[model samples]
Target: MTGDHYFSAQPSTAIQRRDVEFTVAGRDYELTAAGGVFSASRLDPGTAVLLRKADLPPAGAAGPFLDLGCGYGPIACVLAAVAPRATVYAVDVNARARELAAENAARVGAGDRVRVVAPDEVPDEVSFAQLWSNPPIRIGKDELHVMLQRWLPRLAPDGVAWLVVAKHLGGDSLQRWLGDEGWRVERHASQKGYRVFRVTR
Candidate 1:
């Protein structure tokens, strides 16, 4: 057996593929997923809470949005579907995840707007109107902080970010850390052991 984490840059596991179905904003989505990606079989619970509780972009909102740590483009696809005028960057470190995300975007008719890419491939000039993530807390506190520090600053001056963390997984600490990092952090909602944070400049 291979010792591979979803965060692995190249996962050696056999691609056991499947489709994951979920509904958001009263619309349904069916996306393909595979082994070696985060939550490959289903929509992650924290992400589900984030989508359900946070303020989604309006249909008229035009954005260059970011779905950080995008597993298989669920958040990216949903954001693209809801905000048709937006361009979504679905970024992940895992190659397999990126491949599935691209395919899923096309399946959802969001191929033109959703750009599935690696973390480093994002253009330096791009700033996001909104950023969404169910961050990889298992990556450890220091690594997670580094990840946040890297991406959170890329938000446009008036931009907002929505994030969900499990309370059991240092969720409250993360809120405090974001505040300490000088962002205005609001506890947007709490549901089923997850803390949804609304962060802004």
Candidate 2:
């Protein structure tokens, strides 16, 4: 394996393409995958857990949903598919991941609904109605906390964030930290060694 982590802004390794298939909410998805992105060979287990446990937005739920740390756009695509009226922002620091996310969103015919962008490109004035993430935990706790601090506050007053973190990877501690930060957090579910957290301000 290369030294590159999925959170790397620009993965320097050579690209190797593959395909991944998974189902969410009884709908099957087959999307192209490749090297230099998160879980390039398969659906990430934490993401699967998040999708299975989190409450997906209603069909009529409106705009400005966020898929933080989006890798290959699985969460964003699924959200757009489920709530076509919503605008899903697929944000990532990785350039290649953004490219793949755009491609996958287009492949799923969510091109109009899913907007893949670099994290910095999202306008600060925009508040999200919903947020979803399988956060990049290997990036170190401090960095992870910084990322959460930056985005979690962008939730609209009634917005909710769905997050999944591995139990062994400070999931419980993160929950406490969110509480300390004044966000109401709930342990929505625990499955496959992952903690699904529902966060709100």
Candidate 3:
């Protein structure tokens, strides 16, 4: 064992890959997971809620969607699968996660559509039609705020961001904070102790 967090850029833990299977929107996914990435064992409860509750991009949606803090490309793969014409960017700080994300993207037959990259590699000039995240809340509020500050403004004028945070993990407070920051925030849904927020500029 090592003192490694999922957010670590290079996790030192031994990689023991596992298979994760789940269904969303009548679609099934079989992706790889490994130690040292977020939700390595199963689809995270919060992410499950986020995907189930948030509005998925409609078919024919031409997107440059952002899957912020994408762990193993679940959101990215699903978005690519659903919005076949879109470009899905899966950003992660962890190298192993990025590797798995790319592999999973290929596995889902979306290798050509998904761009799995490090956070810094995303170009600044490009804006997103949608951003979906089960953000890294454990990274602390200050860091999380910095991340949001950096990315939220990249939303296109008519774009939307769907976020899921556990209520006990400052979900309500984050919504209030987003409102204070001048973005429109709506409580889209609440399920299993998770708060789904639909945000717009």
Off by over 4 Å in 2: none
lDDT of 3 by residue, 1-201 (tens): 359898999998899999999999999999999999999999999999999999999979989999999999899999999998999999999999999999999999999989999988998898999999999999999999999999999999999999999999999999999999999999999999999999999
Model 3 poorest 10 in a row by lDDT:
1-10
| Model 2 pairs in collision | none
Once superposed on the true structure, which residue ranges of model 3 sit more than 4 Å away at CA?
none
Better of 1 and 2 by lDDT: 1
Candidate 1 lDDT, 1-201, residue by residue in tens: 358899999999889999999999999999999999999989999999999999999999889999999988899999999999999999999999999999999999999999999999999999999999999999899999999999999999999999999999999999999999999999999999999999999
Candidate 2 lDDT over residue span 58-149, tens digit each: 99998699999999889999999899799999999999999999999999899988989998899889999998999998888899999999
- Taking all chains together, each candidate's TM-score versus the true structure is 0.98, 0.97, 0.98
Candidate 2, residue 46: Cα displacement in angstroms equals 0.6
How big is the RMSD of model 3?
1.2
Quote model 2's TM-score. 0.97
Candidate 1 error regions (>4 Å): none
Give lDDT: candidate 2, residue 64.
92
Q: How much lDDT does each candidate structure score?
A: 0.95, 0.92, 0.95
